[model samples]
Target: MCLYFLDCWLRTERYYELDDGDLALFESKREAFLKKYEKEIKAYRTERLIGSGTLRDYNFSSLPENILKNLDSYPPFNGYVYQNGILCARIKIEDKYFYLPPIYDEDCR
Candidate 1:
């Protein structure tokens, strides 16, 4: 199983929020955030590497309290937050599973 954080906004909202009717135009937001968040996450990985820490070993425990609490207002949602070397979100349709962007294009396999 992926060592995932299931309830994170900066880390999960843009994708999972796509199904939330209260959020308008989430599809576009999801795409935009996917690119933006991936770059940000990659940067975090670099930061960790420079400090002698591997990306996969990093954890969210040291993040600020506010940053960790950003998802409080959104409806509760859960999924693999870190997997395949980046964040991921998935949905199922017609018995077929699909990822929001497939982080590393794992879905193409």
Candidate 2:
């Protein structure tokens, strides 16, 4: 289960990269991406709580707010990265780190 989440997180990081830094564009793209992968995301959330005694359905729509609320709790690190005509940023959610507009390389496996 941990591995699955890690994989998804990594994939999201890679997928989040944007060629332009327009946040409105990013939000639109993010929404579309989430909607397209809604089923998989739900399954991931469900598996995440398998043994945690909490069965409440997780809402991805609230992710941005949730991330913002917990942003200061973690150590500050350089979140933004610009490379290969794309820009990305690292974001934290709970203990996990996610890249917004994720870093990517064609050579990456």
Residue-level lDDT tens digits of model 2 in 1-109? 1113344334321222223433455466888755644544443432112221111221223346756565444333334455454333444554775544321223322
1-109: candidate 1 lDDT, tens digit per residue: 1112324443322222123432333354766544544533333222212111122232333334654466233222234455545443333333433333232222322
**Per-candidate count of clashing residue pairs (backbone under 3 Å):** 0, 3
Runs of candidate 1 with Cα error greater than 4 angstroms are 1-78, 102-109
* Model 1, total clashes: 0
Worst 10 residues of 1 by lDDT: 46-55
After superposition on all C-alphas, the RMSD of every candidate to the true structure, in Å, is 17.4, 15.3
Candidate 2 TM-score, true structure as reference: 0.22
lDDT of the candidates, in the order given? 0.33, 0.37
